[model samples]
Target: MTRLFTVPLAGAFALLLAAAGCGGSSTHDSTGDASVTIRIPDPGNEGLLALGKKDGSLAKALAVVHAKVAWTGSSGPFAPAAQELGADKLDVAQGSITSAIAALAQHPGFKLFAQIAPNKTGEGILVRKGSPIASVRDLAGRKVAVNKGGTAEYLLLKALASAGVPAGRVTRVYLNPAQTAPVFNSGQVDAWAVWSTYSIPEIASTGARFVATGGQIGSQNYSVWAVRNGFADAHPAVVQAFSRYLHDAGVRQAQNPASYVNVFTDAGPQAVSGTARRLTIQDLAQTAAPDGIRPSNVTDFDAVARFFAEQKITPTAVNVRPYVLSLTGSGS
Candidate 1:
């Protein structure tokens, strides 16, 4: 019999142990069918939610192997539950190149198998549309909000440093994206170092503009699908299947940007405008690869590891070369 372990919701991270859940034997059901419960990290992220429900790529791919996939949202990026699932809890965890790198550096047991979204233009320095701060340099001596430990903070630090903005040139206001939006609009912060998706439109409503785009700063970033070391080892075939589905999703996301817009509109609660829709599509396409999977030359994982090391975010520098799994291309 498979033992079931119940976890309280507030436990930072919960261990979902169930025969059909987490624990038990890694075997098929009584109907002689294999069960594949994929805990897609951050399922509620508008882009990911739409992909899982509408794209059908994940469903279609898993069906061929007789697996039943289930979705769950994490409190934040890859949590302890995700690490535990290793390969099982979440076949694929979607995160920015920086986040993925940081996660791996911290855990040392995680590996990324496929590229889900290119980390292009996901971030920008948000100011009023016609704000005086037209470039990253303009933000010197201004208050900027950065989400600590997230891509926003890492990118902001690098961008500011390159712009020759002295450490004290800008006031660093640490806040989660949620809190930053309000403060940014109220002028509590002079500018916001935030993601384009959420902060872009929010700042736009306030007549705020982008002072710097990731592309303008030559920041090449991408998101990836990650798995745990042991999980992938125990179930390489399952990992491959999940990786393929994610790659296909990227293909569909790229091929039909408009269709994806509609999908997001239908599946998401956010009211995306025509202009916003176009921008979102454009950003999505920027990260799309030919086969939807390839080694990223843009992100220097080692450099990232070093950054984390300096910041004391990770105990040691991680060599990501061995852990990176390549999807090659479609059907690879």
Candidate 2:
């Protein structure tokens, strides 16, 4: 049982727990609630977060620290979540290291605490069946779809560089995850660069084929989690507890992806089934040594930061070292 108490005069209380549905950015704020609600971002339709939320595992995990979660789900891109974090609307959210680095370059309101590891599969370039393009090397002078500044764009750029194909030669069609499907399915773009959530489903349904994966492109990008600076300062234990829970769950999900079928946040239970589900399970199981949440990798963070800056995506390269914090110790 959670011991409820009341403070007649708490110094500062900014309660911002929002139902804020997915597919659009919506926020709700209040300061009257006695308990603190840690706001988190997700895609809403599918993810481990949604699964845990649906099955009550997440709530149970947070109850140990006397914290609850206010979920914000959106479907467009990962960059907007940074604005939400800066606005004090989100306490923690997940995105590639590049996204975090770019956000830190401009806002400096969030810090990278932990990361999900072995992000080698599910994100890469996909081409429609019977297409003339054979590989990344063949993408020269082709129209490729990518989410600007998102991991997909980064991967496509890296892959093109690896294949000795100039990005200028390949026209990049910038599209969010939502808009690219129709255009790609209709062959408006020669290929689509995307993450697992879209790539897996797209391939399963439309027979889209991956020309190269992030791993194949030698990408060091990671699925990283970040927390608002003030929120981490005030509630380190909650963040730590949540990280521990995720570490355990990540291990489980990697080992037995089928067990977490109910964690679908979008399609209820049946959203992920058949080949897509199989691919999802196979993708996780393929990670022989899953690196669950651990201390921040400063080198990797700095590298990604510089990569973004060099690509003209950010104003300048952020060291990203100061933003790296140790989960087990005082904020680093």
Quick one: best lDDT, which candidate? 2
**Candidate 2 residue runs with Cα over 4 Å from true position:** 1-34, 42-45, 74-76, 262-270, 286-296, 328-332
RMSD of 1: 9.1
- The C-alpha lDDT values of all candidates are 0.58, 0.69
Model 2 has an lDDT value of 0.69
Give the TM-score of each candidate: 0.76, 0.82
Put down candidate 2 lDDT per residue, 1-332, tens digits, no spaces.
11111111123122111221234433222233345688877545444665677778888877655678887765345588888888898888777886677677778888777766536777888899788888898999899998877687788888887898877889899887877899999889999988877888898887888888888888878877787878866665466557666766666666677666535532554467778888877776654321323434566667777777777778788787677664332221
- Candidate 1 lDDT by residue in tens digits, 197-316: 666466445656677767666554555556666555544545545555555566666676655555545445564655666677776666564222344542466666666566555677
Off by over 4 Å in 1: 1-33, 42-52, 74-91, 116-118, 262-268, 289-299, 308-316, 326-332
- Candidate 2 similarity to native, TM-score: 0.82
